[model samples]
Target: MKISARNTLKGTVKEIKEGVVNNEITIQLAGGQEIISIITQTSSNALGLKLGKAVTAVIKASNVMVAVED
Candidate 1:
């Protein structure tokens, strides 16, 4: 599939937390870092996400905020 997001990271499904409306998904990147995404339950089921499954995290955002500790 074609996506407009450029920040696509390949990762493996680490965990899946199911909820009534949404599902929390965690993907572990190559360097051991993890990214979490909350998607609708229907979408989650449509994708058929499971542990150890390889997936790509498509990140498309208008603004990303960053902060530094004092």
Candidate 2:
């Protein structure tokens, strides 16, 4: 597989909030930061994203965009 992702942030799984079936999961990062991604409802178990579980948030610089309107 041609996978290209960079900029990884290591943080513990503060809290895993579940949504609807096969819905997105909220990933809590270090420094009290939160990120939401559309992942399987079972992702929590697959990645062991429970409390105190160390996980990495991979974010490519280019993949991230910033915007501002005045």
The candidate that achieves the highest TM-score relative to the unseen native structure: 1
RMSD to native for every prediction? Answer: 1.4, 3.1
1-70 per-residue lDDT for model 2 (tens digits): 4357866777766665677666555567777887765667776567766677677777878989889997
TM-scores of the models, in the order given: 0.87, 0.62
After superposition, candidate 1 runs with Cα above 4 Å error: none
Residue 29 deviation, candidate 1, in Å?
A: 0.5
Query: In candidate 2, which residue pairs clash?
Result: none
Residue 55 in model 1: shift from native, Å?
A: 0.6
Query: 1-70, model 1: which lDDT tens digit per residue?
Result: 7977767889999999999999999999999999999999999899989999999998876545568999
> Residue 49 in model 1: shift from native, Å?
0.1
